[model samples]
Target: MLPLTRDQKHLVDQILAFTTDHVNETGPAVFTVYGDAGTGKSVILAHLFNQLQTAARTQPNSPLTQTTNYFLVNHPEILKVYREIAGQAPHLLKKDFQRPTTLINQLAKGQTTADVLVIDEAHLLLSQSDHYNNFYGDNQLRSLLTAAKVIILVFDETQVLRMKSYWTEERLERLLMPYPHQHVRLTHQFRMQASDALVTWINDFTHGHVHHLPKDIGTHYDLRIFNDAEQMRQTIVAKNNQVGLSRIVSTSGYPSTLDGGKHYITEGHFHLPWDQYNYTSTPWAELPQTIDEVGSIYTCQGFDLNYVGLILGPPLTLSPQDQLEVHLDRYTDVEAFKRRADITDKQELIAVKKQLILNAVNVLMKRGVQGLYIYAHDAHLRQFLGAK
Candidate 1:
């Protein structure tokens, strides 16, 4: 298990105390952890949930001795990791971890409630019914909130990638307005070794701004901009061979289909298929064979990598003013911008689509803990990025 920082430890202690205090309360209690990527949100949830389970199951003198609880995550890749961890933990069982939809369905069938629910990647929770996932609820979080006495969740609005699960601070605040709640924002980045300037550079770049690269960008982190996509893949492969967990990922505007066939992402000589759905128990990044596959936001989100090679795909272009532009026509991820009944304004819909595209870029760029290597499909954008 990963050790927590002093502040993170204090967060755990505070949340545990809050849970104990609200266990027998009349209405449901909510604890919302707000943080960006790599802010150690998931690790805090992991440690806190473990302690809750250990105390509820083993500590006879503790107030949580008999309290029932569950740990949930909307991402399947992340859920696999937690369940694997639980398999080895003495106090945590595999059954203790589940996807939010699964937990919600089971609770509905049994008409039962849990004392506590700890959720990771809560931003991925479905805000609308997704029949493909068998979720019939209007909102997964609302369902979970209704079924638990206390809900502890970590959310990042920037990580919201799809229209089906679109979220904002305002939307979340409105949902929790009826409940008793506590909110905390964690600012320190615990994953990347990059300096604050480099972090800000990435944020600005994804948010549609292009600035000259910082001179000290590589002092603490490996920052590289490659003119050749093939060379970038070679460097990432070498890094993977040396350090493990390094993978090449791309933005969504690639040739892809959901027909269960191999869809290749070819940039010059760097040709490989997009990451296939993993049927095995191991996480995608941990598999040695995955180094040849190009990961997407779905595979890499909420997971850390030693190094990431990012391909800004066809949808992104550089304007005359050097501003970054997103073209909806070139974006092939049709499912990402599916029309929602509640969102009907044409301008709002376009803005959301562009933001989602940028959100995917932001997520891929932040996956690297030690380094970020970038390549762009647009020639002008690539030149702009590589110039500095």
Candidate 2:
């Protein structure tokens, strides 16, 4: 078992105290665990759940004896599948899996009575304005709080990807002020190399704060920025084959054309290739032939590998005034158009976009145990890396 970090242990103790105290009083307790992406929020929750399960089994009358339900608000389809497997009534799953209102209503119905409700991706519950008409109704965080005796919401407000209404710290505090809750924060990062300067740079750029790490005590990462696509491809292939490292390519625009030779010959993989461009797949696979086969930044967020090669597509160009415009356009749907429209200032939008790219880059960079290879088309970005 991986030893829990100090923050993790503190979180667990707090949860235990909250649960025990609430159960003794026969009341509900709301707890929010906030942290940045890759801060091991889910891991801590899982560990706590396991401990609660063990305690429930050993002491049947324990306050944590209420059925534990762990739900991720991001993917509703998976929840549907789980409901089916659990033999739950169809109506139970109808509660807007994405919305806090639906979740609260469902929990209140007593069909799924959970003593401890663990909500992952709680950042998805920004505010009333942050939601779509089809999903969240009224307030999501407030609705979720109404559901369970011990509600554990794990999220990072700074990592809010989709903006319904603009969110600020003042707004978030007001939203949570009504609840009798304890706010716990996790700071230690177990995944990244302690000495990694890029991690510091990216975090500082994104959050406007610096996260200090020990000097590269372990394997130092090599940063390479390239402008030529072919040259970048060649370098990634050589690195992957020679060192058995995984390669990832990120693009803002779907490639209009894909080189078949590079797709099959190179061991490195691409992210969301099918979504970006048209490609023919080989006989063995059902999906189109694209770098998405290797992995995507979304799929690989909390994961780590021996090596990572990142390719930034056109959207990441230094010249684009609306840097995050491409990212928001690519990730969200048409319904989110109004939210994007609210972003009026080009420079502010570009700054947000830059932060988004830096976050994505941070995600890719931390994946490598020993090395990171970057291929960027933007000349400014290349210059930033001091690449030849």
Candidate 2: lDDT over CA atoms? 0.52
Residue-wise lDDT of candidate 2 within 200-297, one digit each (tens)? 66565344343332345345555555555456556656665676545554533333323443222121342223223222221111132322344444
lDDT of 1: 0.91
After superposing candidate 1 on the true structure, give the runs of residues whose Cα lies further than 4 Å from its correct spot: none
- Lowest lDDT block of 10, candidate 2: 277-286
Clash number for model 2?
A: 4
Best candidate per lDDT, number? 1
Residue 46 displacement in candidate 2 (angstroms): 1.3
Q: Give one digit per residue, the lDDT tens place, for model 1 in 202-300.
A: 889878888878777756699898988899999999999898899999998888988899999998998999999999888899999999899999889
